[model samples]
Every structure is written in structure tokens, then in C-alpha cells.
Target: MFEPVIAPSGTLLGLLQRGRGDGTLHALAAPRAAALTALNQCVLHDPRHDWQVENRSLYYARLFLDLGGGLEDIEAHLFGPGDDPDADETRTGLALSVLGHLASYGRDDALALLRGYAATGANWAWALDELALRDDDAGLRSLAGAVLGRFPATREGDAALAAAVRDAFEPRPWRLWAEDRRVSVGGRVRAARESGSFDRWQRQMRPTGPRPDWSVQSVFDWAQRGADGGSALHVPAARCLGAVAGPDDRPLIVETARSGPDGARCAALHYLAEAGDPAVLDLVETAVADSSRTVADAAVAAFERMCGEAAVDRARGWVHRPDALGASAAGVLACRGGGQDEELVLGALRETVRADGPDAPLLWALADGAGRLGIGCAAPVLRHIYRETSSSQLRGRTARALAATDPSFATGFAVECLWDCEETTREVAALHAETRDARVAERLRRLAADPAEEAEVQTAVRSRIVPQSPPF
Candidate 1:
């Protein structure tokens, strides 16, 4: 029976009484505060229903997402989206109390809400910890866990819960017998796969038959993650990258190369180079067409790396030499260089050396490669950027390039660069001090003595002036 005299206004916790297995105990329709009071009074009458509790547990979990709500909100006002008067928190207890239900009940609504909380980008321990506690459903857990795992800064939140979740779901040696949906158990499965503990792989994961397609899907998916990918979903995904792309596996090597990230692309390229196959050349050759700069860079780098010196010349030819795109392509080829292509490298370097040169737009693609690949051949261009570049950053960069290839100091170029009044030019000159070539030391001595020099230039040269060994 309803108690009208005792019932209050506002919020949905007032008219409630005892609920039970019949799913009809939650009749209150007032504010959460009043609902808790009435529910408390009715608690002495009967217990809450499991099904009703399940739904209410989810609704209370939703309230936790309030911009400024907490446990007190759920304690009094919590109710689910069902018609049952059986909505009760008396057993599930409080806000933190419902986490077990959300993860354990296979509740999509609860999981969805948890993801919404993560969308805030600020630290949300309650949401992450709830997920960390997840024990099954690899697809569901990965969708949430991978995102959270990327932000290690939040690991401190709900430490116990997070650890329990991490430990429970770590990568394992997978031998999924798709006869029935089931998850095998072992605390060390992930460890064995990660550490390349071959003994364990042989001991625990020899395939009983050809693995199901579902199992290899994660491995292929991970390949798409590019460099920052890893998984325990299937047998191939479980194998180490180096082994999977070995010489015999040209298709696998090329497939991984097309995926994301510089490092993975490089790895795949290196493997394919050794695999000695031309099958992936089209993918690598066309990589320049990719919209992502990083992917394009990787693709070019892979072509150069896998295809070697000949690939560099081909990529250079493909580089449209009119604008930044041409200069960039030339630069990549320039770095890995074949001296026979000296004429082309010089032509591009000459274009980059103009007073109106586009050096500042991309020094990485320009002078750096010239200094590395064309040091003997590209020295004049390097010296030109070192001397004529208006940007201090480019000047400093050129100096590093000259040093990288162990420059031929006999060219007297280091002296000219260091003597330039620009502090950046002088900084480039100072690096030649390591040339330990006496002429370089002489140039530095002259620099350190020039009191009229800009303070940065003076400091740079003095630092490189060979200390007590300076004749100046």
C-alpha cells in the first residue's frame, strides 16, 4: 500500500516500499533523497529483486558521470530505466558498489557509459578501474583497455582495480579451439608470448589445427596499428614481428610495410629487403601518394631501404622537382645516395641554394641529406647553406650535417662557416673543432679572439677553441 501522508515532494525516492524477485518493489517517483528515505523505511518490509537491482545498478552508475555528482547522489536517488518498483540500492550499496555488476553482468549500457566518461580526456579513475576489472570478452575489453592503456598517466588511479584487470587480461599464448566459445587460462600466457619465451610457446601453444580466421584477425589488425601495435588475440599475432616477416614470408613483410608508423614501416622494409622480393615494390613505390606525411615518409624510406641504391634513383625520378614535394623526394634519396646520381642531387641542391631558396620550409628534407649523402659531392651546397642561409636554424643544422659524414676539412669550408658573423654560422664552425684538424683549431682561435663578435658567436667559438691548446 502507498503511504500518502509520509510521501514528500521533488526527486523520486519517496513512495517506495519493499521490492522482491517479482520485480515490482520500486514504486517511488520523487527525488533521490526522498526515495532513499522511503526505500529505507520499506527495507524492513522486504528485500530487493536481483533483476531490478541489475537495472538500478546501471542507472546509479550513470549518475556518477554528473559534472559534479558523487556517491551521495547514488545512495539516495539511484533508480534504473525500468517500470519495476523493485529498483533498490540497499544490497548493491553505493556508487563504487555497482562496478562489479557493470563489468560482470555483461551490460552494454554500463560499458557505454564508462566509455563516455573516458571521452572527457581528463583522468577518470572510476571509469578506467571498472574496465581494468573486466575478466572476459576480448573484443569489448580491448576497445576500452587499449585506449586507457595508452595514457599511462592514469594508471595510478584505482591501482588495485587496474592491476587486477591488467593481470587478468595480459597477452597469452593463444590456442583457441573454436569448437566452442571459451577463454583459456594461465597467468603466464602473455609473458610467454612477449618475452619470446620459445620454450613456453612450444610447451603451451602448438596449434591443434589451422587456426580459425577470427584468431588471425587481431594479428592483421595490429599490423594496421603500424609501429605502436601489439596483441595476444591469435597465434600469428602472438609471434614476434621479426619471425613473422622473415625471408620466406614476402607477402607478410610487404603487408606490414603498408601499415602505419615509421618504425614498423622501417622494420617491414628491412625484412622485405632481406626477403629479396619485388612483390611489395608497387606498395612502397606508391607510398608517396599516401595522404599522411608520416606514411609517405615511411613508404619512401622503405623503398630506399628495401630496394637499396637503385630504389633511391627511382624515387628521385618520381620526385616532382618544381616545389617542396620535389625537394623532399630528392632529399630522401640524397641521404641514402649513390654517387652516380651526383648530377641530379646537385641540380636539386642548386635549386635549394638560391637566395630565395625554400630551406626554411624543410631543412630535414634538404641540407641534412645533402650533408650526409653528398658530403664530398654536396659540400659546396652545404657550405652555401652554411654561409648564405638567412635562417639561423638552417645554418646550425648544416653544421651538424657536415660533421655527421666526417667532413673533408681540407676544403677550408669549416673556417669560412665559423668566421661568418652570424652566431648560427659560427656555431656550425665550432663543431668542426672536433675535426681535431689543426686548421679547424686555427679557425676557432681566430673566432674566439674576435671581441666584436656577437655574444653567441663568441661563446660558441670560445667553447670550441681547444681550451689550452689554442694558439690564439
Candidate 2:
């Protein structure tokens, strides 16, 4: 999927897209028409950069409930002339998930829409999964005929049916159909169940990679062949080497790490670094300086895996090199360096953001290091990253860092964080947000009572409400 174009963080649509808590606060305060428009736009055009991992369903569902929104837009989108029933899950997964959350919250219309889609929509499996969680047995059983009818009685059709049963995210409906008194429906479902089980067993029993007794040279050849086929099997090949190679093989592995085929060099670097061989560091330095981007990446990654005192000592010398290795060295220190290394970590944090902007992957480790070492001065940078970056996961890490280092966290971002799209972020706010604020108290109570809130967030809310011991 292409990267979504995110609106500026200040706009209502942007806030909603980012799943920031402030989006809810703003949407509620804005004109209902404008808020609903922005909300509908997000639902229609899934804004998450990584849909499978980032969450926006429950967040959008709550807004729809608050706004008394209708399902006309969602219905039109799902069944519209332009809609493709066979489109990938990314297209309709979010909308279906929002519908599921709505159904769970007792929205009968949402449940009805889900039932309609599950019976006929292209993304029926997703809708079916939603219904399985919220719909009654009767509601689900009623659809088995419509669902099963999609497959014919022919051999090809039966195989398709088997694949569907095997890959289903929820088996409640299929299991229900498997017990139907109607032989046509029950027998087909039963057969599909058996077929799916056999397929799973066959997959488990299949052997695809190297086995015991392969020579070290053969292992290197295997790694190279995998690389040639566009598969990076070097890491596993290195593990195979551990089983296959003895002391006599060290020279060969060392030679491979120094100057060998791209695949073998990558595997040897990974293996020697993992084994903590003393001579491997210089080889890694040489590989990092190589012209091949792939080799350089492997070298840096291999360097990051080193965890000895010697690695830390080497990192101190390489920390100021102003190259990829230097940046990685800083991340190494951030993850494993001591409190005395706070200045170095802070410098790396600043330099990285200044050079590569907030979205740079390097900032993830440096940001965590800032919080880990309690560098209070790092709070401003962390807050900047929190506000500007589009990545919710990275934003969550920044919030955690802010909690540890920012003096104003309780009254500031913590309050907004209560409504943040990510559950872990909300949990963080629940734990540290100052209940002294009227909004915080109200949000805490609402979360405590809301069935939709994650259990972890509710646990944190309960702890804040009923402390270990009441006022002494």
C-alpha cells in the first residue's frame, strides 16, 4: 500500500488520522457537521500507515457514537458502484472493524449493516469475524446459507470452500454450520474442516531448508542461493553453521566475513557477532565501509548485536564518526550504555533529529535512551518528536519518555493522551495523568465504566481511583 498523505497535526482530520486524543476533544467541541464530515472521511479512506498494527477502529466508533452518526456513508462505500468485493483486506478492514465495535456497543443498525455485508459483501470474512464476536447464534446461523452458497458443488468450488474455512479469523459461524441438520450445509462444512486440518498438518510436516550434516561450504552456498532468489536466509544459514561447523571451520567463516559473496559475508557477520568473536569487530568495520548497501546494513546490524564491555568501549570511539556506523553506535550506547553516557546519548538524539527529521528510524532508540537515562534536557526534543511524527508507535515511545523526564507531563500531554488512539498510550496517561484536572477525572470514570476500554487501561484507572491506602 502507498503511504497515506497525513494532514497537519493541528487540523481535526489530521488529529483523527493520527489517532491523537486531542482529535476527540476537538471533534466534540467543533460543529457537529464538520466533525462528522472529518470522521466520515477517515472511515472511507483508511489513514493508518500500518493498518494491521496501528488501531483506529474503536477510536472512530466512539466518535460516531458521540456524534449520533448515520451509516449512510459507510453503506454507500461498502456497496458503491466503484467498490471491489475482492479487494485486499486493507481496503475494508478498518470500516468493518469500526462496525464491529459499534455492534459491540449495542448499535442495532451497525449490527444489521454487518449482517448485510457478511451475507453479500466482497470482504465477507472480515464482516463475519465482526459478527461472530457481537451477533447472536440465531443471527449468525441465519447467514450460513448465504455464505456457503458463494461456493458451488464442483471440485474447484469445494477446494475454495476448504481454504476459506481454514483461513477464517473466526470459526464460530463455520462450527455452527458444521452442526446444521441440513446435510448439504453440514456435510460441506464438515468436509472443509477436515480438508483444512489436513492442509495444516501437511504444512507442518514439510521440510524446506537445510538439514544436519551439510558442510560449512555447502551452508554458504545455500545462503548465497537464497539471496540470489531474493530471500535473505543468511541469518538462519548462520544458525545452521553453528550446528555444522567446529573449531577447524573458524578460519573459513572468518575468511567469508572478511571478503566473500554478499550472502556468505552477511551470514558470517551475523554468526561471528552473535558468537562474540574478538576478531569480528574489525571485519564488521570493513563491511560497513563496503559499497554495497546490503552489506553495509548487515554490518551495522551485526555491530548493534554486540553486547560486551569491548563493544561499549569500541562504541565510544565510533560514536562521533558522523556516518551510518556512528549513528548505529549511538543507538547501541542508548540501549546499553550507562548513566554517565547520558551526554553522548543526548547528543546522538539531537544530531539524529536535526539531520534526518522526526520520522527517521534512528530516533526510536535515541528517544528511549533519553528517557531511560533521565536526561531532563531531552524532554523538549522528545516532545517535538511526539507532536510532529506520524508514527503512533514512535509517538507512544515519546509519551513514555515525556512521562519520565517532563515536569509538566501530568497536566499537559498526559491529559490529551487519555484519548490517544493507541491503547498503551492511554494506559500511560491513566497511570500518570493528574486527576486534578476536571477532564482527567471525567475521562478516567468514563474509561472505568466503558466496556470497550482495554483491560490494562481500566486496571490503571482503578488503581488511580482507589489507591493502595486511602488518605492517612
Candidate 3:
């Protein structure tokens, strides 16, 4: 592996071995503020980069934490308010692996420190995710709500923390619809109908200024004040029991949904449902009472998105409305509220999942459904897109839907995509296949002999198909 750029200092290691965490931490060997600054190094993508193969991504993560600068702080500096997203994405990917570990087994303060970063870190891509995975729902929602009310006072939501929220909120609309459908009993049919996008869901987005990564960001605020049952149904029950803050609370979602924008109410309902708290039923009913048809439709969508096996009978009440059947089917699929309502979801979709249809948004919903339902039955239709679809974009998306549902097929197609180097197919093909696969060698070697290969193709071929591991 290439030598570590920020290797743990020798004396530093010796000191830690002698048992020094708090002392060294407070001493500011790497200032918490300094560590919070971003780190993105530029390398020639040459033999030096090969170092990662030897130790895997070990170059960027653990030792960095051991050095005590803290990954969260580093993420903030790199992606925070004044940072560059594309320029810093590579470094953040390395940092992300580091942050994941910190969340799971780092010091109590280490987790808190990361949480603080999640709160305040620049929107460098993974900031929000790190927040979510670490269970900071309030922070996540706060960030979401704030962003919607007003973008950070910068061009393109420049604040790193804000950017992070936007990244998650940005809809791969088709992907979402398709995923929704993929995981549903209705499969592609639902996607072929009324699924929506970030535009539709935007009414629900609100983002605030970033907070300390160490701050608890609100993942499960429901089981609080010393409540601890650990039941399988705890989160669901908490939500149903009205875990959502009422109108008196800051940014009252129910009120926002009722009187806010077009789909605001749906987003509110959706967020509540995902809270994994069944206690939210009163809130849902209250929302329905206060809602416009648009909002009511959205609230129903929330039920599909969040409520699962725990709230079956109540969820069934939603499917009875054929006009709102799409959202209801999605709700049931999301949490399996009424067991596997595959027929119900599919019944909703049968009218929509047509080829060459205008329902692109719904296609993403379909994909999401298929993924949730875990149905291998839809593979044929997906495989059909792979073989016969004329629109490359749709074809690729369909393939994505398939892969999301069955990762094995995604991996398989990715290898073949590498060889599809015709002008029309090159980037899409390259996108699916990574450069480091074992078979890449043979593929590149084959390309190396092609006199008709484009210059770009030949460069790619020769750069990778090493007869031997080209020494640094």
C-alpha cells in the first residue's frame, strides 16, 4: 500500500500505547477545530493510489481517529459552509468509513463529537447520513425544514451541513418510485402510475443551520424521560401513540401539512410514519381532519412509507379508497401494514406500469416497492428493459430497479456494461463496473489489441491491463 499521508506520528503512537486518551485529546495535539477542517489530498491516480489495495481503505480511517483529530471535525472543515462538494467528495468517502466506525464503538464523546459534526458539519455528502445512522432524527428534520424555508445564505446552499441535507433530499425521483414499486406487492404497476419525486416531496423538506456533530439529532426522541421497553413494536407504538410534536411544537408538521404547501401534509405524515412509532395515529387522524385533499393523499402516503407489520388493520382502511389506492398500496408496502398486500399494491399498479408511459415518477415508486417486497417475480420485466427498451435512460433505470431488487443481477450487468464501449453506451457501461475487478485485467487486455478502439478506450485499456502489477 502507498505510505499513509497522515501517518500516526511515532511518538504519538508511543504516548497512546502508554495510555493517553483524555490527556492527549484535551491537549489539542490536533485541534478539534483543526480536525474539523476538511482534508482532501491530490494524488496522480498512479502507483501511489495502489496503496489502498494493500491495506484496503485502512489508509484513511482508524489511525486517523487514533490520532485524535476526530472524523466529524474533519468532515466539517472539508464540506462545511465554504467548502467544495466535488473537490471534497473523495476525501469524504474515506472520512465516511471512519465516521461509521466512530458511531458504533468510539468513545462516548467521540460519538457525541461526530453527532456535533452532523449538526454543524458542512453539507459534505455524508453529513446527513452520518446524522441519520447515528440516530439524530430531530436534527435531520430540523435541517430538512430549515433548508426548505430558506437555503443557506450562499450560492447553491454552500453550507456543508445544509448541502448534506440537500444531498439526501435530492430525489433520484425515478429511483425512489422504482424502489417503492420494487419493494411492493404491486411491483412495477404502481410505479407506472402516481409515484412522485423530490419536487413532490420538497414541500416536506426543511433545513436549518448545522449543529455540533456531537449533538443528539433526534432519531428516536419518542422513548424519552426514562422510558425503556425495547419491545419490537416500541418505535411503531411510540409513533402511533402521537410521538410527533403537536401544533405547539417548533415547526409543527401537522399544521404545516394542513396549511403549508401542496404536498406538505403528506411529507409530514410520511415523516411521522417513519418515526417507527405507532403512537402517531392520533396525529395522523388530526392531520386528516385538518388536511386538504392533497394533504390527505400525502398523509396516506406517509402510512405506506413508514408503518409496517405493526399497524395492519388500520392500514387496510387506507386501501379501500381506489382514488388514493396508489398511496395506500405504497403505505402497506412500506411497512407491510396489512401483511404482504402484494395483490393490493399490484392491483393499484396494473393500470400504470405500461412501457413507454409518461409515469416516470411512478416508475421510481415501483422500484422502491419491488425492493421492499423482495419479489423476484418482477425480474422478467426488468430483464425485458435490459434487452428491448429503446430509451437508454429508461433502460438503465429499469436495470437499476432490477439491481436494487436483486443485487446479484446488478453486479452481473455491471461487468458486461464495461465492454459495451460504443459511443452511446460507454459512460453508462463504465458507471456500473469498477476499475479494480479481477476480470478487468482480461477485458482491458482484449481492448489493448483492438486497432479500431478509440484513443480514450485505448488509454483506459493500457492504463489498467497490466501484464504485471506496474511498480510505483
Which numbered prediction scores highest in TM-score against the true structure?
A: 2
Superposition error at 368 for model 2 (Å): 1.3
- Residues 291-321 of candidate 1 have per-residue lDDT tens digits of 6566566455445444355556555676654
Which tens-of-lDDT digit does each residue in 1-472 have in candidate 2? 5578889988999889888988999999999999999999899889887887788999999999999999999989887775576577677788889999999999999999999988888889999999999999999999999999999999999999999999998999999999998878999999999999999899889967554348999888888988888888788888988888899999999999999999989999998998999998999899988998888998898899899988887888899988889998999899889998999999999988899998799888998888898999999999889888888888888999999999999999999999988999999999999998999998999999999999999999998995447687
Candidate 1 vs candidate 3, TM-score winner = 1
- Model 2 spans with C-alpha error above 4 angstroms: 209-213, 467-472
For model 2 the local lDDT of residue 444 reads 94
Off by over 4 Å in 1: 1-217, 223-240, 246-249, 252-276, 290-297, 304-307, 319-329, 353-358, 361-384, 387-393, 397-472
- Estimate, for each residue in 1-472, the C-alpha lDDT of model 3 and write its tens digit: 2333332223332222211121133223555443323222211111122223222122223334445543445445444664443353444444454455555544454455455544445443354455455544443443433233333433453343233333454333222333433233123313322323343366558555221222111322232211233222223323433544443543465454345444333444555577655555555655555535545554555555554455566655555454454355444553453326655554443434463342344444554455456556666555544443323334445555565555566356555544431322333334444556766555556556644345665665565544667799
Error of 1 at 122 (Å): 22
Return the clash pairs for model 2, or none: 21-419
Error of 3 at 240 (Å): 19
What Cα-based lDDT does every candidate model obtain?
Answer: 0.45, 0.90, 0.42
